[model samples]
Target chain A: MSLSESTSRRRKKRANGVEFTAKEFKRQWILIAIAAVYVIYGIIFYYLPLAGWIMAFQNYKYKTGITGSKFVGLAKFQFLFSDAKFLQVIRNTFCMGALNLIFSTVMAIVFAILLNEIKNIWGKKIVQTISYLPHFLSWIVVCGLVHDALSSTGIINELLVKFGIIDSPFQFFASKPWFWPLVVLTNLWKETGWNAIIYLAAITSIDPALYESASIDGAGRFQKMWYVTLPSIRPTIMILLLMNIGNVLNAGFELQYILGNGVIQSVSRTIDIYVLDWAINGRNMDFSLGTAAGIFKTLVALILIVAGNTIAKKTGDERLF
Target chain B: MSINTMKPKKKKMATEDLIFTIFNTTIMVLFTIVTLYPILNTLAISFNEGSDAVRGGIHLLPRVFSLKSYKTVIKTEGIITGAKITVLRTVIGTLSSLIANALLSFILSRKRFLFKSGLSLFWIITMYANGGLIPTMVLFRSLNLIGTFWVYVIPGMVSAFNVMVMRTYMAGIPDSLEESAQLEGAGYMTVFLKIISPLCKPVYATIALFVAVYHWNSWFDAMLYNRTNTKYTTLQYELQKLLASVTAQGQGGGGGAASQTDATVATVIPITIRSAATILTMAPIIALYPFLQRYFVTGLTIGGVKE
Candidate 1:
């Protein structure tokens, strides 16, 4: 059939309630072709890795590869659990991640609220702009700046010594106890402003009439902020909080890897660094063990996400999925 | 007496509001200073005489003004090569990913596309679950992409998040426009290239900036897959190595026989060079940020609201 005739026939078929027709197929052929390319790309880069997860169950050797490796039945996972260093790494990850989450979230919200209260448009714009500047910087650059500012001879230590906060300049990087807080601070410095942007948007969407009503009810500035603004953006806050919960284990590796030294390694090592230390850099590279640790991390993240979503659903709030 | 008291109370409330505004503005100004001081300090250190920078009190301005560090950094072979590679990858990576993602989004946004749900589901599943780092590394190695430049470009050619954002943007473009073009016998490619591409400029710019910045900042992948190859090192990775070397030298001064020499060397020039390298690394992004900031904000709002 000619194209036009077939299309007309398809229209007749549609009138008879046929959902799809050959004419529609022909028309969508180009789109289908384009989508196929994405499907192939997705399969290779994404789905292929999922299939590669099977290596976690095997004694994965480089020479033998995943397909040729022997099925080990969770021996690698057992090894990860038995390792004391790994446990320490997990503890460090949780501590750093939790601190980061709490600090960044609270700071972002507070910053957003404070920013929204600014009556001067120029001041608000300038502050918001400057705040997000750090977010654009690479962690490599941020860590370099951090090291410069916190080094023994750096301004921060110099100021502390001059102010008599300390008798002498201290090596911030060398102190194990300072690692978690430093990580949190660095994360806050880089991310708080960027994160605040979302909250700021959320605040903007709030009804002006609500604020007007609050004012008519004789609410003060603080009272309106507390009762009207906060409650209005609460759903946004809850959704973001739930999403962050799912990332509790992803403390990240770059900052710790860059800033960590021999003296502070105990506090600085995260799950990612631990895996890299064993799987890629150790005396005997254990691929299966590393894969198993990764698998464990992914499973925990999945559980956290599902649990978070469940909680959000139960609370009648926004759910990520 | 009650009416007179109400007037005073209203005046008091106005003063209270004024105080709050002033208080809020002060905090913001302080916050801005805190955010800006570090960058300015880094810049100052970079411009300071190498020897003078080590004395360590250069707060807001260069103490002994000199361009020695910048000259040295610019002349360094490692940094120049690393920068060239970084720029090359960022351009290629961003362009390829943007095109690929745009295509996927266009396909998915079409109401008549049969496999939209399945395609979206395939990408979404990957977002939440992954095979983890080791397997991905092994896969890359097996594919012989470890030392190749394609490793950077190919693996990130399509970001699901960008695809979704673009899809959302595309969905907003009136379907009647495309229908009219189709009625005139314009093919899908013509419709996309002529109609949709021009219309989706805002989202395109947003995604492009994001992909470009990501490529520019990425170091971990270069550190991992390109470990054996110095030629593949990016600017961030090179700077990381330079910083590590400086720290290593500083730490070694504590116990090594060459402690005195190392200390002198550290005090002489390493800090300034490190600062200069850092400033150089951040210069491009910081320069371009103001112009690109609005698009990012718009993108964020669109993505956040849709979700």
Candidate 2:
């Protein structure tokens, strides 16, 4: 029991709470019944749905559920900002989450620095195992392979009408300005080889003697990948751009709910398909205006992840938690 | 440091590293043929000939071969009950979320677990808040867990980012191997079933290849709690209801083989039975993707470098 005397007797039995003493309930009642079955399955599935977020200030019903509904405080966030399709579903969830966070983080850092300049280790592990085979398929099989690769006789309109670049064929899911660059090129073909395996494991853990001291100071190989592997993976690209600016409002919900239709439904809806079309697929179920637009998208994704982890801890970087 | 000044700086860095290794091996062989040309053109339009794969130019291979869309996706009784409820929820939701996230990451990597930081801030406020989607579908329709099958094995077991990636890989082992198995009178479930579950077999093979690829790429919790439960339907929600009935018959007959030369779109569900149900939902993740691709490339760099 000597890991610092079992962490100083668990900080004096967590400051003597609930006073357990039968030899500390016979060595912590089977570790308090295995952390009380995940804190009672995190209080019946994550804190009883944050107590059904008070059915977004009531007016909810479903046979009088949230303790006989009808409170209606902020009038379902004032009819979700006087709804113009909830401001075109918050400008299609901030322009497809900022063009899928700037072209899937610049095509997964330019395909992990051009597959880390290939020098054939089995052709960079068979092109990084066939580039994460569309990152484990299903957004309903990547919208059935993005509607058969943008059909109009697919293969991107049979190579843009065989390089004539469009004499015909370019419906691209009935183009509402090609629905946000076809949802950022279908999220860079299902996450550019699973987001370039953490910048190719931070460019293969850098220090090959800083690319042999930037090629003995002459610096070739793309200037030692721009002066030694992009300044040693600039704090892993500012902690993955502070977790992609807290998922810029999670710009996806099964690829705009499986490539939204009615000719790209107003640039494909998003705020989780406007809170599953006003609570569970419309016709006015309106669970308090879909729990007030899912509590304004979980309070603006917990204030953009605590304002991008307080601007990555005041720009020191590497901050998520 | 001078073989005649490193022989003309190694022949002017071998002609600029042979023109940057032939332009980085031709952009990694044209980005691995544009990431394997849409799963090999959906396996050559799922072995073509569903009305000759809707008249378009099928690619990779099959121009006229025919399995008749894998015998209409194996004589679809909703694709064989959504492939027996997506192989019984990807083998019981990846062995019950890999033994409930390695028994709550071995009780939050017990250095001395007295409610380890208030149970790690109660599962890290469920990884940045939830209760979305209408108060989690009105608390899963008041905990009936809506059209059950334990709503796909109980609301995705436990996860605070897979219990902070198995409590940061069981807090990097060696607390003198759980204090020499608590001085040999081993308890905490017999030193987590014999010394921290056999030193967490490489984080239980990286959280069982991330909970068996999130229970075989979940189909939006069987399209939101078994939408009209065809007995807990799955196979990616029957390939999203055959890709919303071939995108509403290619937007009311503009194309998809000119809406099957119209005898009411020749009883829809074509494009070679949605390319043999998208190659039988990604042929068991490309046949267990090269033995779970080195445990999900060290489980996405240990769940993308968390603390």
Give me the candidate number with maximum DockQ: 1
Find the candidate with the highest lDDT and give its number.
1
Error of 1 at A305 (Å): 0.5
Distance (Å) between predicted and true CA of A269, model 1?
0.7
Per-residue lDDT of candidate 1, residues A215-243 (tens digit): 88989999998998899998888888887
Which 10 successive residues of model 1 chain B have the least lDDT summed?
B255-264
Over the stretch B1-307, how does candidate 2's per-residue lDDT look in tens digits?
Answer: 5799989988988997898788888877787887788888988889988877788888999889988788868888877888888888888888888888888888877755656667777777677777776777778877788888788888877777776777777778888887887888888888888888898888788877778777877877776778778888878777777767777556653332111211232346778878888888889889878887888788666653634
Provide the TM-score for each candidate, comma-separated.
Answer: 0.94, 0.34
User: Mind sharing the TM-score for model 1?
Assistant: 0.94
Worst 10 residues of 2 chain A by lDDT: A1-10
Model 2 — TM-score against the truth? Answer: 0.34
Runs in model 1 with CA error above 4 Å?
A1-18, B249-269
Model 1: residue B215 alpha-carbon error in angstroms: 0.8
